[model samples]
Target: MTTGVERLFDELGHFNRFQACLYFAAIFQAISCGIHYLASVFLVETPTFLCDGPSNITHVLYKNHSSSSLEEIWTHYKPGDGPVVVQTSKGDQWELSPCSKALRLNVINFQYDFFGNKTMESCGSFLYDHSEVEQSIVTDWDLVCEKEWLAKLTQPTFMLGVLIGALVFGDAADRIGRRPILMATSLCQFIFGVTAAFTENYYLFVVMRFLLAMVSSGYLVVVFVYVTEFTGIKVRTWTSMHVHAAFAVGIMVVALVGYLVRVWWIYQIILTLSTSPFLLYCWKFPETPFYLMAKGQYKEAQELLDTMAYFNSLPSTLKVSQLKDENDRALLKDTKKHLETEKRLSILDMFGSLKMAGRSATCWAIWFIGSLGYYVFSLGSVNLGGNQYINLFLAGAVEIPSYLIGCFAMDRVGRKKTCAPALLLAGVACILIIVLPQDNDLLAIFLSMTGKFAIAIAFGLIYLYTCELYPTIIRSLAVGSGSMMCRVGSVVAPFCVYLADIWIYLPQLIVGILAFIIGILTMLLPETLGEPLTSTLEEAEALGSKPYTKNAAVDRLEMKQSIKA
Candidate 1:
């Protein structure tokens, strides 16, 4: 059952200097993606602000005082007596209201209003407390007050682009070549990302960001498939999971950069420019031999295999004759015929039978919950009562261990056990936040971080599990469809955070309930721990009807040896 390309990988050695280089190159892409995807967290952050008052009041108040002294004069017109003290477990903390301004009836006395009715009105303009954020979309466009909804709208718009890109580019990579799509998307990501920083208006900025997100999603999808195709089964899981770790590193990098560079547009430019160096070396990148062999270009596949073998210090005896036997040719013909017949099959076709429908639905739901929980935790971390930069850093940092632990658990235990427990733990962590007092910011932060850590595990597990549940014929379609659901979850994440405005605990409550429900529902899924990947619908449907004695470790070793023989 081993493909000729996979056998070529065995001859080249599964893990080698050449493969290491390719792995690092792909890791760099994932890192860039994490930076770009989460950069919006700082870009649109809402800084503390208060009403600027009417022009008459401002002119009269500042007529004799300089702009530097306006802070002294401005205190007389604030709504509160002073900052209100809220008792916390650590100590008492002062909180200020930023939505209203006081109107003075007479500027001369500035005191008698205590006896008369004090007038208060909504802010016509605003003054921001720029101690933390020097500049942001929220400050530049005044996205507070009534305009706050516009700020929350930005992330969902970007995720919408991701949804569309998965549909379009997933298929395009199949029709054209993975290398062309990867290169094209990389170029487009740079152009669109940089252009977004210099936009004249908010609407233009949103449009540019949408285009950037679209290309970014395409690049990630194609690069992942390209890397997987090149890797032998022995090392594929390690390489794939580490790509996500690289993504976490990117998230940490953005947090560090965001802390250092407080200006939003400059920060945007820096993140976009980080990927520019990849363009210089991309020309040397080779197409996956799997793609070449699948297209019947055995000569090119053989030559690439020889180059890889030489670089890996293996013998260069691999040739087109070795790559294509009568059996392989017949198999290729049958595969080609099957592909042609199923070319028009949609995601809905995945539900052709009862067992297929049940498995597909579970996979899709898990995908949705994973994405929803991941983004909700990430975007909501800034709102936790601590240093926003440190909070974001921890959010990214926790994912590293989550990926490591998730990978280990999947290999040692089973995918079902790993995924279900993680989801349940995340649900419990998030739901517990609702019972804590509002002033208990420290405990709230701890629970949220725990939730983030657990959800990261579940999110990572879904990627590997979904691939194993579907047949190779519609594998890409299954992942793409699941990804669409994931993107839908992401698109809804910001709004979930926005729900905090109505009730402070509303977002956490919703996310927790969904995670808990899905955790239970995931038990219905078949465990694919040691199962071989199915190539047809019948084989896929029969995956978990009976248990197998083989374990993943032994199965992997056997597959590698079979390829060598």
Candidate 2:
């Protein structure tokens, strides 16, 4: 018998204007999230700077020499007479003194004062070049020298908020319907994001940013679920992946915004305000009919289906009676009972069977590996030897083709075939960077972009693959638990960039090995292409054990009913 959801999908029609608008609305949130999550990459950039070298010289130069001559004079004589070179812990060499002699101001004129005491002193303040960026967190707060770690910690701190948000919000999204959570999070993201721009202190900025990240993370999860719930099985994968594509578009947009706006605060304000329209527009979209049916709100479900039908320019043929007619009423009651029965299913239950245990563990590992690779490639852009803005933009742009390729390949070759090789390719690309000469920067960058593309393909495939692996009862738990691990990977990504100080290739090597190992493990998973979605734990375990034809799941359900009888 057709489920109420099936009937609703049939009546409402697929790929209609109503669903299209909803997808666009969801994409708006995706774009905002992409910008917000990575905004720190540009806002806190460390530009070329040196100690405010001898203000006395600057004073005299301004009073005597023309402004045009100042640059020429400063450039000529700034190098130390005998440079005090120091090697960093990472074995890189740097000069201790920016200038050897301090220039002096005579009564009415400036002089280079060559005979002035030649001594090196620790820098008290810095002067940044304003040619590129007007102001960054690095410049505003002087996060150089001993405070450099503060700048490096910013991404991780926001990621920590994401970690906390995933734990709390994923559950909240499940408990409350997806729509309310989305609305609340949209408002919170706007408020906290705007507040972050005006924060006077670094700590306060971190706090506001944390809250913003938390809400933004919730927005991601809720929107993903909300969009998935409304879409039919035929168009579901594309609809969901399109949100991720929107995220890539957001990254490019942020790169453009950052390129144009030189000041950190202004860039932030632009991103924050971009979310304002979502606050009002979100209300126009209705709750998913599935959630309404799950909560036993049959009238609301019918009303929503009817509205969808009308908006789709189809007849309002769906009715409440058609949903709970005698047969489906019992089925609906059984579904409610089934949901209640699965409520007690714990994380331990995910490992109840051997095949399930292996599947869960392998998928979890792949999630961690994929997430680690994705963020490491993305966040590592600032460190790449090129125009940071251009590098960041390319990092995002490279993923677009991967998403497109994934959408095409998964349907033809199946999830395992596509994902396993994608991981291998990503791993090989990252490892290849390790052998390339550092002087061959173009090759390194090309390899890095290739790795990102491969990882993006794997990342998209894993979401679909994971969804197919678990039964409906434990689906949320399985995906949520896996996402928690993804957050852990994100939290660790910043440290990978930091480790570049020790060995530039260390992070890549680690991620590469993990990817290759996980790729092998991914192949162990059963191919789920064209198989019916598993509705029960038993069916999930039995999936790859036999020839899973169209009615196999139904046959199992009938067998269970007969045994009970």
Candidate 3:
């Protein structure tokens, strides 16, 4: 017998206007999420700044002068003896020092050459460069010097929210329904995101950002499943790939907005409010029939199917009479059994068998490593060898092609072949950066972008592959678990960038090594291309063992039946 999803597809028609509208509507959520997740790039970026210097120096000598004049005075009076100049083959560069002492400024003269010997004292406050950004959280709150670590915590805080949100909302969506949870979270995201833009205190800002992240995670996870269920299997991969491409567009949108708007709060306001329009139109989207069938709400499922058929300009093929009372009772019994089975299942079940345990462990590790590498490149773009705006845009822009390649590879070759090779290439590219001359920024950026591209491809493929690997009952839980690990990876990403303070290559080294090992682990996963989705835990377990044999006669009969339906 055909499954609920199959039946609906037959009636409503795949790639119809109804499904097209649903996919199009859901994609805005992806775009909004992309902008919100990375808004920290512009929100907390530290502009060029130095200590404000002693009040006596500013008020006494430079009180009447402009901010620039005051800054010049500070530079003159303060230590000209900061970093030591080391001559390199490319150019003169300041050698990084562990303990560059501050000299006290005891005397001042307009004619005095700043490089001349002077006593330097610790600066009491700071003056920031306001040319690019008028005010970011870093400048407004002075999140530098001793408070610098606090600025670093913002990215991780949002990630922690995502980690927690995955566990909470993933289970909730599976139990409550995708439509309700999706709507609830989208509203929450708008509320929290907009509130975050107006926050005056850093701690409150963090809290708001955390809430925003928590809600958006639900939107992201549920919407993917929602869209996938509505589309036919033949075109599902393309549809999923386009969702990610929309995310790339969102990334570019943020870059353009940041470039144009310069003020942090205003940028946040625009980005956060942009998603409101989608929320308004979200009511038109339909809940997945698969979800309704799983809950034993066959009547509602049939009505929805009829509605879809109407919208798609097809006949009302799914009538109430078609859902036989006996079949409905049997489905209810199956649903109850599945619910009870789910209650009994735990994380241990993923590892209940040696074979399944290995696969689960490998999938989790690959998710973590791939996500860690991906975020490291994305979050650390400001530190990359180019203009921050251009770097961020390119980082996102390159992903469009990477996602396209991933879609093609998964469709043609198989999940294992596509994911493993992409990850391996990412690892190799990262490691190759160490061999390139740091002075040659062109080559350095090229290699780094190559790594980013490879990682992006791996990320896109793995999400598709992971969903295919799990049974329906535990699908959300499995994907959520992987996303939990993914969030942990993102949490570590900022600190990875911080490692550059000690050694520039340290972060890349960590990401490269982990990716290589996980790439090998990824190869061990069973291939799932052209395979039907498994519905039971037992079926999922058998995937790694025997290859599925196709029955030509059965397929031909089903094809004829589908055509008639």
Q: Which portions of model 1 show Cα errors greater than 4 Å?
A: 1-3, 54-103, 106-108, 112-124, 326-349, 535-538, 547-565
Give the per-residue Cα lDDT of candidate 3 at 14: 68
What TM-score do all the candidates reach, one by one? Answer: 0.86, 0.85, 0.83
1 or 3, greater by lDDT: 1
| Model 1, span 446-540: residue lDDT tens | 89989999999988878778877876667767876787889989889888988887887788888899999899988888888888866567767
Using lDDT, rank the candidates from best to worst.
Answer: 1, 2, 3
Best by TM-score: 1
What is each predicted model's overall lDDT from 0 to 1?
Answer: 0.75, 0.75, 0.72
Q: Which tens-of-lDDT digit does each residue in 403-510 have in candidate 2?
A: 989999999999999999999898998889897788787788888889889898888777778777877667767877888788888899888877887987788888
Q: Evaluate model 3: give its TM-score.
A: 0.83
lDDT of 3 at 93: 21
Which pairs clash in model 3?
Answer: 52-125, 52-126, 103-119, 103-120, 103-121, 104-119, 104-120, 104-121
Ranking by TM-score: 1, 2, 3
Q: Give the 10-residue window scoring lowest on summed lDDT in candidate 1.
A: 84-93
